[model samples]
Target: MSTVTVTARGVTPDDVRAVARGTARVVVDDDARDAMATSRAIVDRIEADGRPVYGVSTGFGALANTQIAPERRSELQHALIRSHAAGVGAPMPREVVRAMLLLRVRSLALGRSGVRPEVAQSLVDLLNADITPWVPEHGSLGASGDLAPLAHCALVLMGEGWVRSPSGSRTDGGQALAAAGLKPLALAAKEGLALINGTDGMLGMLLLALHDAAHLFTMADVTTALAIEAMLGSDRPFQPELHAIRPHPGQALAAANVHRLLQGSAVMDSHRDDALHAVQDAYSMRCAAQVAGAARDTRDFAAQIAERELRAVVDNPVVLPDGRVESTGNFHGAPLGFAADFLAIAAAEVGAIAERRVDRLLDVTRSRGLPPFLSPDAGVNSGLMIAQYTAAGIVAENRRLASPASVDSLPTSGMQEDHVSMGWAAAVKLRRVLDNLTSILAVELLAGVRGLQLRAPLVPSPAGQAAIAAVGGTPGPDVYLAPAMEHARAVVTSPELRTQIENAVGPLS
Candidate 1:
């Protein structure tokens, strides 16, 4: 198993993925422990002095002005977790829950959240033990630090919620902790609030999305190249000189990738100087780089925002190095919200364009000289006709999902959080959009490869042949289209196939 050492310094996206999706153990190092101890000392001072710290001494949100007696302060913290653990909807994916746990530990380990070393260590134990709390999907407004979702996690730490054990058995949190030889955490002043007060949930989803988008966008470039060849489209548009004049970094990279993939292609060579071919290919074939590149640029922008968030201390009443606890609005998730929404829009456009290419590959009028739907017998067998319909349906769904969730908000916590970021919604919807985009690209690959097979006597480039082998599917009378489509999707997502393609064409951007 891989190991990720947590320190006061924030973690990278790869660190999050390792612990979330891979068998990685987590260790909170001494620097983080020391930082947490120093911050805990400040919290102790505030509690000993009985100062009216917002989260330390008083009620929360609209009740901040109300003071609690010292004897009931611990009760206050426990009650905060119980009340805020009111998330609804189905349980989140284990990977998402794990990511949330890891990011929460990262925030607390930074020591600004005023959590004790043990508090952060408890989360580390959960990650290392593979104990994932049952966090629900629909609770965060993307403001107030993913309150409900994080509270569910906090509830697990207190041994009061549900969790999936290392053996994948669903059990009570206390039982799971005891079985792992770990004890439930006792509430301390500001500890519960600290545990639940960060943008960890949404940020985790954003990081995971960014990671997957990197692969999906690269595959988009590969599929675009295949579609260009299958449709007998000109590769001149991908020339570096044409892209150089425009000079968008993503556009140049995308153009270069397609250009490399299509090198030495007999299909492109056959149509290179043929006046019999159409004067210009359709926009979907000719402008593939521009659309996919724009999405790549957008994905990069979202990544920049996620990287900054990874290093941020996103909590209320953060402990300052100057020996003071100050309340701030750093927990607002507008940055992540805007970035997630923007990336969804970009991904949707990529899927939309790919769907167009799929349609073209199935259309006899547009697919150069390929048969209708690439079927051996046009009317006797409907080859990939309905495949285009699937792509179209997903594209339409993606269009609706592309509507920005960040722009919508509702007041929560007695209007204390009057303007919510709705970033959690944006992140969730972005996941769906990416899933839809993957399927759409798979359909395009399915059709594009079949179209290439139909042009058998005129072979494709070496890279194209490698991709066809990677996404293997019989191009004859449509037998069972569903399984073939699923196989194509599996191939699209397989890292091994991506590696094989790179071996043939050099690395894609």
Candidate 2:
């Protein structure tokens, strides 16, 4: 049980992933607590002075003009959480909900959102207890800081919403808290607004997607190298000299990875100087590094945006050092929306190109003398023929998902929140695209490894041999294609396989 300290400086993408996917504990640092106290003094001053500050003494969006009496202010905060917990769909994954809790704690711990230190600690308590609030998948428009999703989380803190207990059973929020030896929080002035007003949901999903994409992208490069050797294609196109002249950073890195992976390969050496054997390979084989490189660039660009968002204070009516509370539009999620949408397009392109390589590996004419479908018995076994179809179907779906959700906006809150960001939608779609890309690469690995085995005496490179050993499914008269395909997919997604490959051949880009 490792612990991640949340400070005013904020946490990293890795920190988010740890708390989200692993059993890591969270702690708010002392400096962040002190800062929260300093900010709380300002909020208290506003309340005592009887000034109508937005979110502090007044109403929320589309209702900001209506002022509430001091006696009714606590009720106002309670009403906000109850009204906004309006999400309706299947409950979100536990990891995603855990991430939202960690991120909201980070936002409040930053000290910009005027909240008592206890408010932030309550979220940490929920996380430490492994109590996940039941957040529906379809509430946030990704504007006003993923309001609906965060509201569901806030409701749990107040012991008034549904939650999944540590034992994985659905239970009332109050019972869950009591079972974990924790107490529910009482909302104060501006506390409810502070709890829900942040881009934690979409941002959490983006970070997780980026984490998975990093592994998948490297696997893509590895599979492309295997495909080249399996197809008896020329590796000349991956020369550093060729990539250096054009000098796209990602292009250079991708080319170098493939070049390194193909070192000391008997298959590539067999037809090195035979001009008639392969004067030119097809676009999928020849331009693999180029397509994967472009996707790498896109992933890096999205990472930059995510890093900046991680350090942001994404709430309205932020407390300033000058003892003033100013309302700002920092809650809008446009930046996160664009980044998720861009990454979706990149993932789709990578998967689409890999699908093409899978098709080539199965075709007798294009596979350079390999048997049709790589079947051990030509007519008796269909081999991995249907696997290619599965890959193609997923690629088609990914193309549709790549359509930018950020570009489509439906106004809400009586048009007070005109032009919502829809970042949550974009992030959700990106997750699907990444999953499809992983499956697509698995199909290629299955075909490519079979092709390598078909070449017999002409062995693949060291890294390629490691990949073959990792996905040890012998090419023969097909025996239950579904299980073999699943095994290949599991190998494709495993970190152990990537570690094995990198150990054999240095490190991939």
Candidate 3:
């Protein structure tokens, strides 16, 4: 069953990854439910006690002093969602909407958002039913809390905007609610603000990015292992005892993994392996453990931030239990904006190194006895020549994108949001980096697979051949790389790929 647990405590990055992978359900604890009710009471008390609050009884943003008549408060709340739903352009991807809904519910679940239990449940219901909001792909400053995109998210709950269904079709809010046999929520005070005022958009993208980045981080090891065998490097470098000399956890883990990939390999045999025929190997081939290890460290570092942000409440003018609403800057995206850029930097570096390895594979000089471009018919076929170009293009694009998005900030809301996080830009760029890195790995995989085939009859290390079968090879020769690459991508995301890779390289048998 799909489930997510919300306690007063925090949600971890691993939890977000689990939800993204479709392995769990989302639920709020009784404590959280009770706390939310108390919070609503607090806000109500503050109102009755006649204390001026930021958003509860007052107007928002530039209109803060413009008193909202009691009769117009609900109208204002509903108007806020409808007006903010002014997001333009194509709807956000279904996966992103899932991430958004997950983050929003988690944020509310912290019991700080002063949301009614029913309001929170409505969000949970949407997620469980796979009801994706028609959030536009653009419009957000990462300040004032991802307003536009989030407003669209809230709109679906009120039965206003369109919603994309689980069956891969789009329908009107009313139609979708009817089809699903659900009723539109009649939102109460502070509910719309809670829904639209949070950092869910930027947070959602980061959650998804972190999840995918973790997957690719592991896969990078698989390709690097293949490259290790293709280069026929010394297994001595990966010896567990040798790595214990320095003992960086990442280094040790990588060494152990490569060791597993090289286990019982005829290719690593000094007397039997062709590697001994050469004097030395390329840096990329020899330094695989060090390079990818650092990337893993980066991933671990960023994971810490994402984990904390995943469940924390992040919205303004939070309604409290004593009916006392408080305004604060928890909605600021700076924390996550920095994380997104940092994750992107890590992703770019990994891709850059993979590109280097790909380059070495193509360089006749660096290729160490392999024909130019890993092709026997080098000049006429160009072999993996253009494949390198594609990889190069991807790396170059990431390099440009790696410029820290969080570093650039501009004000909006008439200076109400002066110190922006630029988080949306960071999340989007990181996602782009993820896409490029996948293609680069695919190119590397293709070259490695072909190189092993050329050394066929001799056979690769048992580890290498098994992994090859696990990937199932790209389609036939004429499919052109882009489609083949997309197919390779789908395969990698499958449970079969990871299981196969693990099985093939397990204990290097």
Candidate 4:
């Protein structure tokens, strides 16, 4: 596997994708090790001074006032891990667990978390060996740094939890480590807190979501262009001069992408001077760039936030350079929570508008000469009718998912941890929104292809032809529909369709 080295500035979304997808391993930098050692030395000094260092010497949450003796401090770390590994429900996907491991390791590698260098190295070893801990889908309040899910991850390093082996078999953590020719490290003071404290889980999900949005939004533009040409709509709204007056960067980029995709289309030129083409297209087609561009702008903001979180040192009782180990609220998930919530709203809106386009394509009156539902024999076969229904249901679900989780506060930890971020919930829902959107866009693209094929002698642009060709398979009399829809969604999400379009159209924003 390829390896990505971690520095204090942290990893990028691409790095997270590589590690999560199991294509790469992470290596801590030498400077990070030096910093870790420096922080460890400070922790040692604080221990010698007999000061109550929150997680280092005293109890956690409501029990912070209760101090522990040095002899039992290591035990405290182990106990913290065992107790906080209380996540429930279905196990998270391997990729997400792997991302959490990578992010936690990166944060610890920064050396501010007061962990021994060996602890950081152990996380790296686990990731390199491809042993993923079984992290559950629930139990994080998006505060205290994804506590339960991360604790589940930390437990594997101590050889005290179940793990998925490199061979994709389930086994005990100890057995996995033994098979990999490694041994589990004993937890030291503040090590457990370091392991579980960060925005890694939410951040990981956000990174993956951000990556998905970039592709889907681009695909949205491609699919929208196809729909516009198939419906005989004008591309005049996307002129750069018209966009310059309003000057939203994302709007301009999206408009340019659609306008480029529609270039050299005989179908568009056929009606360029036709005075009777309903004056202008509906909001779904005419304003696609505006809605999609706004989503792009929202995505830009979320990306900025994710980048900021990547560089953050999120552990409590962080070790300072001047030998001071002090507790802080760096672990709060509010920033990430808000970003996730905002992106979900954007994804939902994108899907909502895409569904509208699909509805317009299927309507007999609105679809121009195209047969109802894009079916050759409209009365005998209901082509892609229920497909729009499927898209509609998912879009509705996305609407519900878009409701911000950050605004809802639930007191936990005996009210010691009040005003929880619910950021993890926001991330979870955003993922669902994105998944739904993929299917929604797929439906729209499939409808556009069917409509374009029906246009027959009137051909679409080279980019449109490339999109149709990448999706393959001709539109036919009613067939088992799932496979085509699945193929369309896959092609839309992957680079195959985008690459095909860009090859024909030069480049897209």
TM per candidate:
0.98, 0.98, 0.90, 0.98
Model 1 Cα shift for residue 126 (angstroms): 0.7
lDDT of 3 by residue, 248-354 (tens): 67767777777777667665563334544555556676677777677677767777777777656788887654544678888878888888888788788778887
- Kindly report which residue pairs in candidate 1 clash with one another: none
Q: How well does candidate 2 match the true structure in TM-score terms?
A: 0.98
Model 4 CA RMSD to the hidden true structure, in angstroms: 1.2
Whole-model lDDT per candidate: 0.89, 0.90, 0.74, 0.89
- Rate residue 198 of model 3 by lDDT: 75
Kindly report which residue stretches of model 2 are placed more than 4 angstroms away from their true locations once superposed: 165-169
Residue 197: error of model 1 in Å? 0.9
Selected candidate, larger lDDT, 1 vs 3: 1
TM-score of 1: 0.98
| Higher-TM-score candidate of 2 and 3 | 2
* Superposition error at 285 for model 3 (Å): 2.2
lDDT of 4 at 218: 90
- Model 4 CA deviation exceeding 4 Å by range: 165-169
Candidate 2, poorest ten consecutive residues by summed lDDT: 164-173
By lDDT, is 1 or 2 better? 2
